[model samples]
Every structure is written in structure tokens, then in C-alpha cells.
Target chain A: MNYISASPALLPARAGVGFKPEHFGAIAADQQPLGFFEVHAENYMGAGGVPHAQLRFLRERYALSLHGVGLSIGSPEPLDRDHLARLRRLCALYQPESFSEHLAWSSHGGVYFNDLLPLPYTEETLAVVAAHVDETQTALGRRILIENPATYVRFSQSDIPETEFLTELTQRTGCGLLLDLNNVFVSARNHGESALGYLASFPLIAVGEIHLAGFFDASEAGAPLLIDSHGAQVADEVISLFEWTIEQAGPLPTLIEWDNDVPDWPLLLAEAMKAQDRLRHAERGYARRLDRRAL
Target chain B: MTSVMSGVAGDFAAALRDPLVTPPAMLSAHAAPAASTRFCVYRNNVAVSLIGALEARFPATRRLVGDEFFRAMARLYIKAQPPRSPLMMRYGDELPGFIARFEPAAEIVYLADIARLEAARTRAYHAADAEPLELSSLAALDPENFARLRLAPHPSLEIVESAFPIVTIWASCTGEAPLTAVEDWRCETALVARPRLEVEVRRAPPGAAAFLEALARGMSFGEAADSAAARAKDFDLALIIASLIGGGLLVPADGVKQMETIHGYLA
Candidate 1:
């Protein structure tokens, strides 16, 4: 099934925030300045209820994005056909501008761990992940953005840099990247690598969207590890990294994710406004470049 | 193929639940020997988040037991049976049954019933929406025909029949009412349903559960009411119908469901 919306089915190059039910009444009352609203696809998969009701209301006003966290696209097993069908139904009904999932696996052997577990970036995993992505794109009949996972451990499996692995997967499957800046900083700092170096190697041109969120510092560990706990505000370093990526990529559809310790409406809106500031700054740079080209 | 893929992913999964099993050789936490938080982080997120989902679903149950006691018991439940559904909202289907057998929570005899009430409410919140049977439709029916007509229960209708006053406990825990001692220590049946947007829960009248159960089993209104009245002499038919309308428990009549008895199916 396909749906053609009045607006283009693509995320605008502006800031968005994840939709939470608590802010439903607030968003309904005031027409906030936001590019889009993203919802975890699994949470709204029920047959009918307030979730559907609220999502329908949001879909009418905002450019919605169905962000999936449970597709398990990185798993070695075949994608859950039932889950893929549900995603298809959701996309058809909501007509979201964009849909995305993680580069990590959350389920294996019929048990879902509810966490984005890491994978070894070997030649074998690359093939498995690419094949899964191909199937997912085929199932949805549209491209998806795969977000990079924040990890505390590095796999000793085969020789493959994370950037090269992601680049090859995008090339093989013709999908886009989510480029979570917090994840890049978290994974790189944990492994004693440079976030700038990782971004330089990242496939920036194919980024359809970007994710900016906060992390918890497990500084007490043997080596510093940052947990991708989206509880607090976006860190200064991550906001800085997001600015750099916006400079390079020219303000893609950025989303502020405050899933944990979800703040009051004003706090969440403030977080989105923070990203909007960076995007507006990048927008000016793009317009200046275009004017220069016209000259 | 399963084994090949499982070789790495499977080993990693096995280690998540069991801390004794170290992170597979495929992982290196900063090249440190015998020291790292890699595996622990994943384990912690899985446990904490799953427990959090449980806590969200069974808040009244959690409030009844203190946070410390709830978390400790929830931890045991998580270890024994991790969620089968990827959807977190549907994660704790087996929890009420789990609580029924738990020794530590055994003393709070009504704890399991409260868990059941909460679980049913969660299901009702997500249950399929249907237009409820209008009260006028039933009033129009002839008294003779009304006895034979069977009403279809609403898709979201669920009843928790308990020996304790669990509805009061749940209402108190959820702040719907202040905590108060139950003057009557009689059995109670709680009906949970979502006819429209809101999910409503309240005490079901005497004999309503049996009547509804029989009605659900495809018994005619007359037969079900007869059984209920015979079992409970104080059964009031008007009150039962009123409760059904108020709770949106039944939709308009369709074909009467085929009755299934103990021995065989009845047409």
C-alpha cells in the first residue's frame, strides 16, 4: 500500500522532537515551531486507543517520522515478517515523512533484549546487515535511515572500521544514515578515537537525518564509557559536534531525543529550539553559498 | 545459517542475561584484561528498561509494594522470563501469574489480583475500538425475544473476579480515592473496558461476572441470567444491564456465538 501526502514525504531540513503523550495537550494548544515529530513505531502499534488518537492529531499538523527501535535489522536472522508488515501498515496509515532504526541488533534467537546490542563489524556481519537492509527497504518500498549505536565495547572479530562498514552497507542497499552525534562521541571517546576523525570518514552526503541526544558518563569504569541514556539535555560537546555536522551536511532534518527523564513541555521545546538555533545558523551559510553561486 | 549467525549474536545474547558468561571473545573493552563495563552496560539497560516497562504497566501494584520490594521482585521475574514480544507495552502478560506464585509477595493475598486488574487495564487501553451497543436497541426488543438474544461482549471487556476487594485497593493506590479500610470483606469482581477513548474500571455487581462469563460462552440472556440468579439469590437483572451499559461492556447483537460446553460444542 502507498500513500501520497499533500506535502512531500521527506523530512524538512529543520529541527524536530520525539513525540511523547504528556505533551499532547500542550502541542495541541499551541502550534509550536517544529519541523516534525517522531514516534517509536512499536509503541503505537496497538489496534486502537489514545495512542492512535494522539498520533492522528499530530500527523494532521506536523511532518511526522516513524522512528522504529525494534526492527532488529542488524540481526543475523531473517527480519520478522510480521513486524515488517506492521511497519508497512503504520507507514501507510501515518504517511510519515521519514522512518529510521538503529544499526545495532536488539533481538536474537526469538528473545528481544530491549537494548541496542553491539555487533562485530566483520565481512560476515556486513553481508548479513546489508541483506537485512535490502529486505527492509524492499518491505517498505522506500529507503530508511540507520542510526549509529553508542557502544562501550569494541569487537575483536574481523578487521573493519565502523565508518567503512556503514558506508559499504549504504552503498549496497541504497539507504541513508541517521548520524547520531552523541553516539559518535560516545563510541569514539570510549575507544580512544576522535569523533572528528570518525565524522570525516562518515558518509555525510547520504545522511537523510541526524539525532542529537544526551549520554550518562560512567567515568568510574576502567576506561571512560558513556551510556546513551537520553535522560538529560544535549551535552555541549554533542551540540558542538552537531553544529560541525550541520556545517558539513547543510542542516539535515535534526531531531532532539529526550526519551528518558522526559522533561516538561517547555524543557523539551527548549531542547528542540537549541537544535533549531544551529540549523538556522547553517541555513544562512547555505543561502550565502547559493548566492555566491548565482554571482 | 541460524547457527552461523547465532555463533556471534547468539553468544553475545547468552552473556547478556547471565553475567557469569563474560563478553564473547568478539568484544574488547579497551583491550583491558578482566576489567570492563561493556557487557554490564547492555545488561543494565536491558534489565532497567524492561523493569521500567513493567513498573509503568503495573504502577498500582508497584505502589502497593514499596519500590525496593517491587524492584527486587521484578528483577526475579525478569530473570526467569524475559519479554517475548518486542513491543514493550505487551511485555508483562505472564506477570500476574508470576506474582501469584511468588513466595515473598504471597502474604499480600490481594497483590496478584491487583496485578491482574492493572494488566487488564493495560490491555483495554490498547484493545481494538468498537462502537458500543446503544441502550435504546435493547429497550426496543420485545421481552420474549430479549430472553433469547445474545449480546456480543465488547472487544475490550475484561473482568477480574477476586476474593478480595482489589478494586478499592487499586483505586486507592492510583489516587482515585484515599486509602481506607474495607468494611466488607466480601468477594468482588472488577470490570475494565474502553468503549471509546477512556478506559474505565469499577466494581461489578453481584452475579455479574458469572452472567457475563456465561454470556461470553454464548449462553442466551435468559439462560445466563437464570444461572446467575440461581447461584446468587440477590442477582438484580436491571442492575447488571445498567452496569454493562455504563461500562460499555457489550456491543450490538450479531449472530449468537456457538455455545461450547464441557462435553462438546453446541450450535
Candidate 2:
């Protein structure tokens, strides 16, 4: 079904906040200019009721992006066809502007973990993820954006770097990327790599959206361990990386994701405003670079 | 599947389920110790997230048992009954049964029933939408034919009957009724339905539970009333009918052909 229009112009290249049911009343009552709202597709997979009611109201006002965390797109096993069908039904109902899933897998052997479990990046895993993405896009009848995962451990047998794997997957499947800057920072810190170096190696041209979320920092065995907890404010360092990303990729559809310990509407909106400010700054810089090229 | 990837996924899944297991052997050794700690982070995330889903699904159960006890029990439940699907809203379907068999919670026998009621409420909240039968529509029916009328229950309707006073317990836990005020220790039934946006959980009237349950099973109104009257001594047909209509429990029978009884009356 032609749920959403074929044009890739639904969401504006500005900042939006993640939609939480707690903030539904406030969002409905307020007249804020938001770029779009993103929600976990699994949360609204219910048969019908308050979720659909709230989503219908929001979809009328703002563009929506369905960010799925449980597709198990990178699972070694084949993708769950039933789950994909439900996702397609949801997309048809909402006609969301963009639909995305993580690079991580959450299900295996008929048991779902409810957490985005990591996968080893290899030629074998790459083919698995590419096929899943291809199937998802075909099933939904729309292109999808696959987000990078925040990893805790790297596989010893893996030969490919995450950036290269993601690049190749996009190339093979024609999928876009949802560059979650907080994940980059968290994964890099946990693995003792430079976030900036990772960003530099990232294929910015294929980035269709960006995500900024908070991480919990802990020290384990005297080494920095960053958890992608999404429980706090976006770190200044992660925001800097976001700014760098915007400078390189121009103003993409940025989102402020606060999933756990979600604060009231105002605090979440303020975070989105922070992202909006960065986008504005990046927009000005892009215009200036264009003028410099003209000169 | 590549042996390396399959091996890593299997080991990772095992370690996430049981922390005592060593970190996946496939993890790079460059940050071996840190990777183990990081692996623990994933383990913690899996446990915490699943526990959170359960806590959200069964808030009353959690409140009945303190947070600490609930978390410990939930962790065990999560490990034993991991989700078969990725939908978190549907995660705790087995919790009610699990609680019934849980030894530590055996003292509170009514806990499982309360969890069942909560699950029913969740199901009702997410059930399909349908326009309820308007009371005005019933005015056209002949009074003599009312007994033979067949009415349908809304898709969101659920009646949870329990031997213990689950409605009282649920109400007390949700602050609808004071705990001290719940002195009646009799069996109770809860009527869960979402007539509008909010899911309403109310104590089912004396015979209304049986009446609604029968209607849900496609029984004729006369038969359902008979079932209710058989169950409750003070079954008032008029009062139960009013309650069902006013509560938005009844909908017009759809798809089922109206049948003619032996008396040549349309049912």
C-alpha cells in the first residue's frame, strides 16, 4: 500500500524529540514546531487503543519515524516474517515518514532478549544483515534506515570494522543510515577508540537521520565504560560529535531520544531545542561554505 | 550461517541469560578484561530491560510484593520464560501462571489472581475498537422479545472471576479503595473494558460477571440471564441489563444471522 508519499520530504531537516506516552498530553496541547517524532515500532504493535489514538493525533500534526529495536536485523537466523508483517501493517496504518531498525539483533533460537544484543561484524554477518534489510525494505515497500549499535564487545574472529560493514550493507541493500552519535561515543569509549576517528571514517553522505541520546558512564577495572542507557542528558562531547556530523552531512533529521527515566515534556523539549540550535548553527556553516565555494 | 558468528551469538545469548557463564570466548582479547566487564553491561541491560517490561505490565503485582522482592522474582521469571516475541507490551502473559507456582509467593494466594486481572485490563486496553450498542437502539425492541434477544460484547470486554477478593485487592493497590476498608473477604470478579480511551476496572455486580461471560460465549440474552440467575441469589435482570448497557459492554450482534425461534420471534 502507498501509505506515505514516495518523496523523501516528510520530515524536515531539523530536530525532533522521541514520543513518550507520558508526554502525550503536553504534546497534544502545545503548539511547538517540531521536525518530527520517533517511537519504537514494537511499543505500538498492540491491536488497538490508546497507542493508536495518540499516534493518530500526533501523525496529523507532525511527521513520524518508526524506530524499531527488535527486528533482530543482524540475527544469524532468518528474520522473523511475522514480526516484519506486523511492522508493515503498522507502517500502513501510520504512513510514517521514515522507518528504521538497529544494526543489533535481539532474538535467537525463538527467545527474544528485549535488549539489542551485539553481533560480530564479518562477511557472513554482513550478508545476513544485508538480506534482512533487503527483505524489510521489500516487505514494507519503502527504503529503511539502519542505525549503528552501541557495542560492548568485539568478536575475536571478526575481520571487518563496523564502519566498513555498515558502508557495505548500505551499498548492497541501498539502505540509509541513522547515525546515533551517542552510540558512537559510548561504543568508542567502551572500546577505547576515538569517536572522532569513527565519525571521520563514517560514510556521511548516506546518513538520512541522526540520533542524540544520553549515556551512563562507569569505570570498570580502571577503564572508562560507557553504557548507552538513554537515561540522562546528552553529553557535551556527544553533542560536539553531533555538531561535527551536521557540519559534514549538513542538517539531517536529528532526534533527541530519552527512553529511560523519561522526564516531563519540557525537559525533553529542551533537549530537542538543543539539537535544533546545533542544527541551526550547522545550517549557517553550510551556507557559508557554499558562499565560499561561489567566491 | 558462519560457524564463528553462530558460535559468538550462542555464547553471547547464554552469557546474557546467566552471568556466571564466562564471557563469550569469541570476544577480542585486546581488551579482554574490559570486554568481560562490557559483556556484563549487556547482561545487565537484558535483565534490567526485561524486568522493567514485567514491572510495567504487572504494576499491582509489583506493589503487592515490595520492589526488591518483585525484582528478584521477575528476574527469575525472565530467565525461565524469555519473551517469544519482541513486543514488550505482550511480554508478561505467563507471569500470572508463574506466580501461581512461585513458592515464595504462595502465602499471598490472591497475588496470581490479581495479576490475571491486570493482564485482562492490559488486554482490554489494547483490544480492537467497536461502537457500543446504544441504549436508545434497544427502545425499538419489543419488550416481550427482550428475553430472546442476543447481544454481543465489545471486543475490549473481559470478565475475570476469582475465588479471592481480587477486585478489592486491585482497588486497594491502585488507591481506588482504602486497604482498611476492604473487610469483606468474599470472592469477587472484575469487569475490565475500554469503552473509550481509558481502561475501566470495576467490581462486577452480583450476577453481571456470569451474564457477561455467557454473552461473550455467544449465548442468547435469556440463557445468559438464566446462567447469571443460577449463580447469584439476588440476580436482578433489569439491573444487570442497565449496568451492561450503561457500561458499554454490549454491542449489536454483527455477522450472526438473526434466527427465528419456534414462536416465530426474531432472536
Candidate 3:
């Protein structure tokens, strides 16, 4: 099932803010050249209210994407049918340009843990995640994007590399990857690997979107630990890694996520501007490469 | 594969409920060095995030009980009552009821009510929207018919009557204050309403609480008046009607055709 917008959003490589209620009035009253606004699908789960009212007003002018944080896609349990139904309803109502979820589980047993928990990249877990993704795609009757998660620790029993696991997921389910370069940098640093290597190995052909967000460096002793908190500006190193990804994957619809202690709209847009610059640079580079090939 | 997934889900539930089951690994015999640590990270994240949800939803309660005891109680409550919905904002709706029966906080008798007020405020903040009736509609009605007409409160209106002075405690705890001492000897009533988009809570008068409570149940003006009278025979209908309308409680009755030139001797 391929999800395509009837009138697709013109996601220019420009700055955008995480659509929040705090900035609703500011966005509504002001005329800012924001690229697009992103919202968490679950936050607007309610039937009708001020949030919906605000979103309805904003949707007319802004290109919207529904990013989900707690779908528990990698859980071994059966997908929550009702939750998926609500998601489908949201998709039907908004007709958002893009939708994505993390390649992590937040629930075990019948209880939800609320945080995106990591999963071991064994064949067994891969098969489990693939089935869930298949079911989710079938339920929504549309293709969705999967994001890689940042982990504080790695499992010794895992067999496949994270990139290989993600590639296999896309190959089996035909869903695209919403690669977060920050998460790659975060997970690689914590687990002792090269972010560049991870970027090189990523299945660029299956990449649908890119995410650039801030991370916290919880480095202790001599080791530098990167935590994907999404609570600050995009780090310089992460941007460098993101540039490498764009050099490989070209210009994809990228997002700037700042969920905690969120700054004012202008500040967020400034950070997004930085991403837009990198994307434009990548696009120009791609154009030059094509021109050189013709010559 | 489905069966294996189900088995994992079962183990995951056990890991959250039974703290003794530390690692969430599928097989114990093949446990890796990273498995235990990763599982611990997952456990800590779950415990902390869920507890944070509870704290955000029930800040007054947390303030009352302090941090250490609050975290301990939150952990126990989370295991017993994991959220039934994916909507994180609605996660801790049952915390008030849980706090009421919580053995550790049994000594703080008012803690449960404070939690209830906080939860009510949260619900009111997210309740469905409705257009309020114009105040002129009420003024046009003849005072005699005011008692007979039905009054419809806003959908988000909630009246909570508690034995504890929850409003004063919540106000003090939320604001910087030379803390007003609540004479915990008497019961207090708090009325919550979303006049605009935000929820507002105010202390309700003795008879006013009864009047609004009855009206919230879809009672006619007369019935609500009688109910209020039963609670306090000296309940002044005029005062309540004026106050309720001023607070955006009643809406105009449909097809209330005004009679032009009532009993005019000569037009």
C-alpha cells in the first residue's frame, strides 16, 4: 500500500517549527516563511476540540506531517487495532503529506512503557517487526516511514547490524526509512562505531525522509555518550553527518524536532534554517554531479 | 512467530509489574552482558517517564507529598494501573482514585482531593468546545418564568464537592504565598468551568454548589432550585441565577419566542 497525497505538500528545504499550542497564536497571526509544521498524531487523538480547531486553521496554509512517537512498532505483541484505526482516521481527516514512526517498541506485555525502547537486531525480532509493519500498512491502507532509534546500550545477543535490519524491513514491507542522522550519531557514539560508516551503509534508495534534531552528550569518564533528547539546537557534528547523508541520499523531506524546553518560534525556525541551508547545498552538489557526468 | 511475540509481550508485562523480573530478555539462559544493562535502561525510562506523566497531571499532589515518597507511590500505582490509552495526556486520570486508597498517603487525608482537583483541571483543559449563550438572552426572560425554564451548563462544566479545602491548598501550592492556612475542619466546594479555552476553578458557595450540581445533571431551573432549597432552604434563587449566568453556565432555550407588547391596554 503506497500512501500518496492527492495534492502533495511542497516541502521546500526551509525552516519550520514543531506545531505546538504555545505557538498557535503566533503562527496564526504572523506571516513567517516556515517550510512546514509537524505534529504528533497522538496529541490530536481527541475527536474535536481547540487543538483540532487550531490544526484545522493551520492546515490550510502549512504543509503538515504526522509524526508518531508511541506506536510500539517493534513490539512482539499484536498491533493495537484501535490505535491504528484512530491513526487511519487522522490520516483520512488531515491527508498529511507524510507520516512516520520510530523503529522501536514502547510496550511490553499489555502495558505501555511510554518511552521508545530499543530492540535487539536478531532475525526473530526482524520478522516480528516486519509483520507488525505489514499489518500497520494494511490497516492504514498506505505506506508509512520507519525511523531508527537512539540507544543508551546495545544487546550482545543481536545478530544483524542496525542498518541491515532497517534495510531488510524496507525490502520486506516496502516502507521507506525516515532516517534521523542525530540518532545515528547518538547510537554509534554510545555503542562505539562510526556515524559516517552508518551513513554510508544506509539504504538510500529506501530513504523517504531525514530528521535532524539536537542530542545531549552524557559522556562520562573518557567516553562521550550521545543521548537523542531532541531538546536543543541541531549539533554541529550532527549537521556534518547529515551533510554526508544528503551527499549519499540527496534532498529528502527533512524535519527539525525539538520536543523539550521548546524555544520560541523564531528560534526553532532559525535552527530549521540551518537544515534548509544544508539541504540546498546538497541539492546544488547533486546538480553539479549530474552536470559533470553530462560533460 | 506470533506465539513467540505473545510470549515476549507476557514477559514484558511481568518485567513492569514484578520488579524482581529485572531483565526483559526473551531467554534467560542466553543472556548477554548488554542485555541486562539495556533492560535496566528500558525499565528506568519507563518508570521515570510514566512517573513524570503522573507528576505533570498531578503536580499539587506531588507538591504535597514531596519527591521521594511521590516517586515511590507513582511507581506502585503505575504497575497496578498502566494507562489504557495511547493518549499520554489522559494517562493519569485514575490517579486521584488511586491516591484515595493509597496506604502510604492514608495519613494525608486531603491528598486524594487535591489530586482530584488537579485531574479535573486537566480534563477541563482538554474538554470539547461549545459556544456560550449571549447574556442578553437571559435578561429578556421574564423573572417569573426564569424558575420554570431549563438551564444548560457548558459541556466542560464540572462541580466537585470535597470534604477537604482542596482549592485553597491547590492555590497555595501552585502560587508563591505566605501560605493561607486551610481550617481543614470544614468541607469546601470547587466549581470548574471552561468559560473560554482555559479551565477556571473558583470556590463555590454552599447553596451555589447544589444549584450548579443539579443543573449539570440536566435538571430544569425549577428542579435545580428545589434541590438547592432542600440542601439550604434559605437558598436565594435570584443570586444563584445571576451568578451562574455571569459565569457562562446557562444557554438560551431554543424557540423562546418573546411576546411583544404583553397585555398592552392600547397599542
Angstrom error of the Cα, residue B249, model 1: value is 1.8
Instruction: Sort the candidates on TM-score, descending order.
Output: 2, 1, 3
- Candidate 1 clash pair list: none
Candidate 2 stretches with Cα past 4 Å from truth are A1-10, B230-232, B255-267
lDDT of 3 by residue, A7-75 (tens): 222455454667878878778888667667889998887534477778888788888888887788988
Off by over 4 Å in 3: A2-10, A25-29, A47-50, A122-124, A154-157, A222-224, A293-295, B1-13, B16-19, B25-35, B144-148, B176-178, B183-185, B208-213, B251-267
Ranking by lDDT, best first? 2, 1, 3
For model 1, the superposed segments whose C-alpha errors exceed 4 Å read A1-9, B2-5, B31-35, B136-150, B219-223, B254-267
Cα lDDT tens digits, model 2, B151-199, are 8877788888899989889988988777665677899888889877789
Question: Considering only the true interface residues, what is the Cα RMSD of candidate 1 after superposition?
Answer: 7.1
DockQ of each: 0.44, 0.45, 0.24
| Tens digit of per-residue lDDT, candidate 2, span A7-115 | 3334689999899999988898887778999989887877667987898898888889999988999888989988888888888878999999999989988999988
Error of 2 at A243 (Å): 1.2
Q: What share of the true interface contacts does candidate 3 keep?
A: 0.34
Q: Which ten residues in a row have the lowest lDDT in candidate 1 chain B?
A: B258-267
Interface Cα root-mean-square deviation for all models: 7.1, 8.3, 12.9
